[model samples]
Target: MVESILGYSPVLRHCFRNVSGKQFPRFQVIKAQAMELAKEPGLCKEKERYRDSLVGLKPGSWPPKNRADNPSLYNPLARQERMGCGWLGAIFEWEGVLKEDHPDLEKQSWLALAEEEGRSPPPGFVVKRIACMKNEQAISEVLCWSRDSSQLKRMALRKEDIHQALQGGVYRFRDGSREFVNVLTRHKIPVALVSTRPRKNLEEAIGAIGIEGVFSVVVTGDDVYRGKPDPEMFVYAAQLLQFIPERCIVFGNSNLTIEAAHDAKMKCVAVASKHPVYELTAADLVVRRLDELSVVDLKNLADIELTEFGSTPELEMDVEEEEDDRRPPSSAAIGDGFW
Candidate 1:
């Protein structure tokens, strides 16, 4: 039944909004109200009418029942299937690297590259995979451990081969990313990409698309002292924007990224660009595509609306490009040099 609904509209995936009521799960206030109304039919026509008032509830969608729904194949639970088998998988599947030559790519992509080379990964890539709980718990744990001096020390002291493995070329972006970045920039919300991808590929991709200037900041794996599910990247991004962490909103397609934003106290909006819905439960809101979001719509997002920017640019584009050491910017350069 859930699959049938998902087939029709996969974007309206799952709910994560906190609801209140002694009786209903958080965010199901209207259902609780409807039950009361059911006992007083004279006051309301039906439970459906009362249920419509709840926040984040779709108008006509029925809530899933745990007993009736299969949890194993649930969208969120099954999202692991969509992670594309990590960087190595993407390299082999695409028959090529995802990036162009870049000077500042993070050292991490070397792991993916070495795997592609069929050579033994450096000892750093062989770092022990710590036992992790499910997404939500892992997020909290990553944050807690990142703050430890011991963990940081261990990460910094990787074998020399591992450090050598971190170097690599970067990804080249297609025109689609440029258009998307343009849309984001025109909305007057300074755009920034918070990615777990190594900085090298991100730099290459942004340069290829020609829109690197659109984003005021790019928080890559190297930018943060720790990666997701640690909040370091999110917090670093917030700091770069000079915005309060709570005032920032993040869009991520992964559980780790969503958890990072949550841990940082930033508003998190998850997109189903890759993972399924259930995997994104940690986010405050979920959408199937980021193109659905508009600057005007963002203004209405109370949890993440733009209250102010110190000197944010208004919606306008000036066409131009500039030279740089890394990958070329992805979108049309902002002519005003606002960046």
Candidate 2:
């Protein structure tokens, strides 16, 4: 009876029979099926409402104001086009690097640095601190623990050991990132991996994820004098890919990366896997999962002319501020200019 109702294999049926509560299992399965069936009407109504809302809007002006916050606004049927150049930011948390290693040590290091400076760490420091740590400036400014004592060297050694261990371990791809990359490859879009991790560690993580050759270009923290919240990495990536900054679409999960993309005058899609949707408001578009973003969306974004959104005071301010903060350090202190 179970096999006929649910089409379970004989092996599954045998296992179900071995269970003492057969009736409860059968009832639960039937209830779940019934509930799913009952949801169809509501689902259809929601979809119809979404479609109706798009009726009079301009083409490609989807995600109506009412549905802006709804992640289900992803239109699978939306048109797809061949994108010129694509820049993919490595989803660090999804790669299992954060899970396998402790970010706490790095956080502690930053806090210690803050203590030495006799100042409280700024709010949202960790968001940029982790990325900054990859740059030599961070080591010189925030992590000058060596000057204090040998204890700092031991801490640094322990951190190095953790990173080494991460290189040997495997990294799990985010739920839909692999499929998303496959789609981009199939469309022949040139995608580059821009990351805040050091090149060696970034390469190792990419290799562990089994996508070593997926990206045409890989830019790491070691490649740039500055890190996130700075457009240097993204601009350098655009240069390496031979893409105009405005034509490239950046997909990132952090506020700093999104800001970097905007500063570079590139369209950015914020993946809210790491941060909340509200926090990612700076992005051109926000989605709860990578799976929600499709090739169609990329094409639409790529075709958008920057002039459509006239320059705003806030945007101008952001760009100006970035430029102000990006002054070239002395050659003796930090080498050449950023990028």
**Candidate 1 local Cα displacement, residue 242, angstroms:** 0.9
Q: Which pairs of residues clash in candidate 2, taking residues 3 or more apart in a chain or in different chains?
A: none
Candidate lDDT values, in order? 0.44, 0.58
Q: Give the TM-score of candidate 2.
A: 0.53
Predicted structure 2: lDDT: 0.58
- Tens digits of per-residue lDDT, candidate 1, 228-305, equal 567776677767775556556776656656667768766667665445788788777776654455554444442322
**Best candidate per lDDT, number?**
2
Segments in model 1 whose C-alpha atoms lie over 4 Å from true places: 1-178, 196-201, 302-339
Give the per-residue Cα lDDT of candidate 2 at 330.
35
TM-score of each: 0.41, 0.53
